[model samples]
Target: MNETISNSPHQWNTQELPVVVIAGYGPSIGESTARQFGSKGYAIACLGRTQNKLLDSVQELKASKITAAAFVTDCGDTRSVKEAIQQVQSHLGRISVIVWNAASYVGSDLVTGNDDPSEILNQIVGVGCAGLLASIQEAYEDLKAMKGTILITGGGLSGYDQNVNQIAVNNSWMGLAFCKSSQRKLAGLLHARLKPDGVMVGTVIISGAVRVGGGLDVTDPDDVATAFWEIHHSRHKQEVHLGSLTQLASEPT
Candidate 1:
């Protein structure tokens, strides 16, 4: 595993690079996080549902010395996640890290007095839990061999704030809230169980909306990326909260 980077952050060159598989990647914090790792000589694999957005992100990262690729992935599906990880390993050498940043924005039919109990269960389990399990299973050997980490992006809606959860309940955002809460729990559980096996698990609770456009200007994407980098660098701690927000998705960035 040899890598070289010039004094310039953009001049990264590597032969055998560890792969950071970012699931649920998008144009905002996901892209920034990719660059943050790319600048550090890690090859990046951005897995998302949108092909065009992933390509755009790849272009942005390639502007530097980073080796990046776009994989159209449905992180909500176990098969898709497994296949994506396989593709990443085949392309980027090995799976060194996983960034779980995807979620379903579907209305909580269960909370809103409608019933899609089965679908909701599948979504929550598939995207945030079972899907992650599949991802880990696919790369577990490599990750354990490399002593890598699983970083989850979660925040206020993880049953942390009664007001936020209540607002989500009121607004039928219970689905996303459920995802956040489950992911928070997942991070803790994985942290405890995987630590002995050389894998680190951590979650960043972004209290503010990601600074992408007109909302949550307080949470800069690069800052969020830095927080992830720092957590990975420290290689300990189960979770960290970033930024400040009075409400969840209500205050308009």
Candidate 2:
């Protein structure tokens, strides 16, 4: 492990601290995951496209007395993703967990059909599959050294297709659904390939809506984050469906 902290946030050799790199740092899952890991003494490397958002998350983490730094990068770009991982490793020591929670679609209008089909497909795949591949490739060595965990955020779309009307189905959403399914498959493949090497890969497939705020709410981001932490520690279960799985199970097919 690289026992060299550039800034040295905690006074001690901060490099000795376990690090977690959140690829898609955001208000929901990303923030919650950071806090969850930070509470457990993990240094956080938050990667996102928006510097302000990244800074906000880092500030909150620091306010909570957690060592954190923000890295600005586009997860959709493989080169950027690789560079971000290298930078994180250089600054924070070896990474113990990396959460790929950066998703592209935000419930916008879907263009199920487009004149430039290839362009749209590339955009979706870049965020979903390509970015993940780049991150995994770059972080594989570091993860292997620490026996790390790779946690992915997934939606209920991967589990089952909803029966909503055609007008309600946005093309972008359909694309996202496809991307979610692809991510799940990729996660399974990664788990199969890396499990033997002691690198745990898992996906937390959320079933319902995620909300902000605190308390004992099951759908709260903080609570959802616990599932992610559990998934990493468990190491045995490759996939965990939170919120929606039971509803899906009870529904008539």
Candidate 3:
């Protein structure tokens, strides 16, 4: 199960280093997020389905002299997620932060009837919402034992109205409701139910498509990474939203 190259350096030289597990390690956000956390002395465990891409991300993070390991993981599968978390714990010692950023979209217009609406909704809920549940469940005990932070990455629709097509296909209304409910429930359970044990659960609602130079501009991967870092460092847990497309003007192309 060790897909990472042996030459990889999997050790950080910091006394109080934070261990972070990023489930959806995409080239854009994953890499940027890892680098940002690494710069702050956090050992990163980059997990994704693509082995090559995961390795590349690990190498890039290692270039900064940060401890990093790449593991092939499928978030939709609970067994796979559980195994990945175990591997991360073995390599990084203890996971202090868990970021669930995995999502799936088939690009079908719910209004046009281009594809099976039920299937698309199932995939989104399964991967976007259910996958997150699996990740958190698998790592919850460890986070609680270590007093870690669980930060879930969300979309604009999770908090606001936009993208009519996405709304229909992903059932944004129901999906967001589920997300909010889960966040509050998780926070209550962790903070209230597990207060004696000491664990924090939080969510970061990322509004708008994350892009450079755009109105209601998407948040920068680095900024999002910083937010994750902050969540990990802070003792309290809370939900926070990024930018608004309606408030900010688009950058001149």
Candidate 4:
């Protein structure tokens, strides 16, 4: 198990802290997840392409008395992702967990076939799958040593029925839908591959709208964060579905 701080936060050592690297650090799920883990004594490593956004999240985390820092990098690029991992280790410590939540997509007009076919496919591949692969390779040593976990964010576009497909097409979310499906499969593959090595891997497939502020939101960011934490501790349940899955009842166990 990764070392946890038993003393005051003021006496914490950054290098001795176990890091939780958020691949697509943002205001929603990422922020919630960071807080959830940080409160548990893990140093948060905010990884994203936008420096301003990363800094904002870092400031908020710091304000909450959580040890956090940002690393700006394009998740789709292997070199950039690997470099960020190196930087996180240098600044924080060994990475004990990774929340892979980066995504990309083409515009509605592009999906309507007005642009290059390859572009649509490229957009679908996005930062989700590739970034995850890079992180696993780069952090394998620390993850195995600490029995770390990887939690992926998936969407409803990859589940349910034609209702889901219709919703995806209506909103021009084809690329995102494809990416989520791919991410789910990637999570499954990693779950089986990493299990023997003591590294748990799982995916939270959100089967509806995710609104951080609640209201009419079908999925809550805090819930996702809680699920991640549960998965980390239990080291079981490779896939967890939210929202729409509640009605399905027959979701694979």
Residue 207 C-alpha lDDT in model 2 = 59
The lDDT leader among the candidates is: 4
Per-residue lDDT of candidate 3, residues 163-239 (tens digit): 42234335434444444434445544545654566766666667656754334455777677767667767856466
Q: Which stretches of candidate 2 lie over 4 Å from their true place?
A: 1-15, 106-115, 160-172, 213-218, 245-253
Model 4 lDDT-worst window of ten: 1-10
* Ten contiguous residues minimizing lDDT sum, candidate 2: 163-172
Query: Distance (Å) between predicted and true CA of 71, model 1?
Result: 1.0
Cα lDDT tens digits, model 2, 1-253, are 1112224354222647898989888988888898998899888888888876776677777889888988887888899898888888777778789899987673344453444766766777788889999988998988899999999998776755454222125333566776787888999899999987799998888755678864231377887689889988888878877764444344454
Q: State how far residue 115 of model 3 sits from its true place (Å).
A: 5.4
Clashing pairs in 1: 215-253, 216-253
Model 3 off-target regions past 4 Å? 1-17, 111-118, 160-196, 212-216, 247-253
Note the Cα lDDT for every prediction shown: 0.77, 0.77, 0.66, 0.79
- Return the TM-score for candidate 1, rounded to 2 decimals: 0.87
Q: Candidates 2 and 3: which is better by TM-score?
A: 2
Instruction: Supply the global lDDT for candidate 3.
Output: 0.66
Candidate 2 clashing pairs, residues 3+ apart or interchain: 110-170, 110-171, 110-172, 111-171, 111-172, 112-171, 207-244
* Model 3 Cα shift for residue 118 (angstroms): 5.2
Q: lDDT by residue for model 1 over 1-253, one digit each (tens)?
A: 1111112332222487888989888878788889899888888887887766777777778877678877888888888888888877866677888988888776564645565788777777678788788888999999899999898888777866677766676666777778888878877888889999989988888775677533542577787788788889998767777766555445442
- Each model's TM-score? 0.87, 0.85, 0.77, 0.87
CA error at residue 241 for candidate 1, angstroms:
0.5
For residues 1-253, what per-residue lDDT tens digits would candidate 4 score against the true structure? Answer: 1121122343234448888999988999999999999999889888887877777778778889888878887888877888888877866778899999898776454435567877666656758787789989999999999999999988877864776666766666777877887888888889889999999998888876677754443788999999999999898888887766343333332
